[model samples]
Target: MILPKNNYLKARNFILTNARMIERRLFEFHFENGTSEGVFHAVYAYRNSDGGFGHGMEPDTASPESQPLFGIMALETLDEVGYLTKEIILKDFMPYFKSITTEKGGIPWMFRPKSEYPCEEHFKTVKEWAAISTTAPLLGILEKYEIDIPWMKKAEQFVWSEFERIKEKHVFCYLCVSRWLTFLEHTKSQDKAKKTINNLKNWISNNGIICEDKTDEGWGLYGKPHGLNYAPSTKSILFSLFSKMTMESDIKELISRQKDDGRWDTWYGISEGTKLEWAGIQTLWVLKVLNNYGRIQY
Candidate 1:
């Protein structure tokens, strides 16, 4: 597994130079042989006054108020770095989600924050709905940690029931489907995992239209569907069916896409004032995936 060392260095340096302290420390823990203690502090630093995550750790939104979803984001990041089973992620966060959860037992996909919170403008206006994106990954985190919390059981049932209903016909949202793939990677329901990925692929065949930019047969695509960075290619639409997501082109593109200073750019940065944060996240995300797959060693 050959890595683009120079580019990897540049990406790491970009995180150090551009990211907030929490993100910066966490980046170090992943790339620089830094301490798990650093990860713990960094993960907790984003905890808002109300005990859930806020202050922008999620990167997509900039809410200062505590958000239930962001708590999962924080825990997921910690999970990425091997900080498993922190009570902070569950005890405090479960209540937040439970409060905002729909009657159907799913968290509102878009929990709109109060206007005063620093946020991405797009999130402020997003329509709320129950979604696999909100519930599925969180369940994956709980299952991975083997945490037997009561609320998680309810959420899991909700997610499975929803997927069962859509087993035959569904609209694939690249946004949620990508995360759903992550959940499936860690889920216990192996049979359901098989069924769900197939449904996702079928959704593409049904709804996808020809687009110059989209990969994966031009379905399940969003953002720069044509750009190499955003394109999933033929391998990606049904990528959920496979455990590993990298292709040779994915490695090459990961190398090629790094900016001169080392950060990866994102579509979010184009419209949001928080480009630095999102790009930092993008860089870290690309590095994590590449590193995990043995495409990059740095």
Candidate 2:
């Protein structure tokens, strides 16, 4: 038998082993039994800190605390391992999902006792790129759990409308581009989806390998990079993998960047006075994309 050979196997093993290090505290409610907790812990942790995952919004790490998005990473890992379940997902994870929503019907990037960030930014009042990026993954999770939110239908409508509004413009950043495309694809808006795809292709062609614009780099939102704009993580890879917009050479180049051990270098901000590796969540996301495309072997 020809076993699948590539860096993906090594990456898969690395992820599997590191997954054990995930902090159980964040997931106390979900994993009470042998049931899978979904990605809630990872999601909550990442949002609680910077708006993105990885280590301190800088380098990549494997520990759960070190890796803020560990919940989502864990969920992806469970899916890859074929251990995800519906009951545990619904009972434990869905409650938090409801909490992320604002009274205005917009989802914030993170929740704090008093306020939320990026309250003013987004395509429409209903669809914030950061919010939708965080929420889109839950749609699949929700389906499995049989938890229905009528607002989700409204959110879907908002997403479709936003796609039409933005398809003609230059698309930038991984989350906005990826989530927009994912939403369009999932909702079956083939024409709008294609337009979104083409927009990404146009961006890649004009911007070259690395997107350098301040907006694309996650600047100008709060006059800083913030957590959402860090580079070389799931958001970046997702834009490349799912949109059907990137060139083959670009795709190959991205794949080539994967280390023999299955991790990608952190290309975003480096936190001062710290040396933590911070790309685990981003790396896992890229791995998921590769797996989805059948580029990685089981």
Residue-wise lDDT of candidate 1 within 1-298, one digit each (tens)?
A: 4567777778888988887677687777866788877887877878865667777666666566676667767767777677666475567566667777777777766667775655667778866777667788877777776777777767778888888776534343455565676677668888888777776666554553223332433221243232222224333435442223335544565566668888777666433447787777777767766665566654
Clashing pairs in 2: 42-71, 55-278, 59-277, 59-278, 60-277, 60-278, 60-279, 61-277, 61-278
Model 2: residues >4 Å from true position, as ranges? 1-81, 112-130, 140-147, 164-170, 188-263, 268-276, 279-298
TM accuracy, model 1: 0.77
Give each model's whole-structure lDDT. 0.65, 0.42
Whole-structure CA lDDT of model 1: 0.65
Overlapping backbone residue pairs in candidate 1 total 4
lDDT of 2 at 169: 50
What C-alpha RMSD separates each model from the true structure? 4.8, 9.6
* lDDT tens readout by residue for model 2, 148-255: 668677555555554555553525454444444434545444676676667656654455434334234322121222212322234443344423443333345456
- Models 1 onward score TM values of 0.77, 0.49
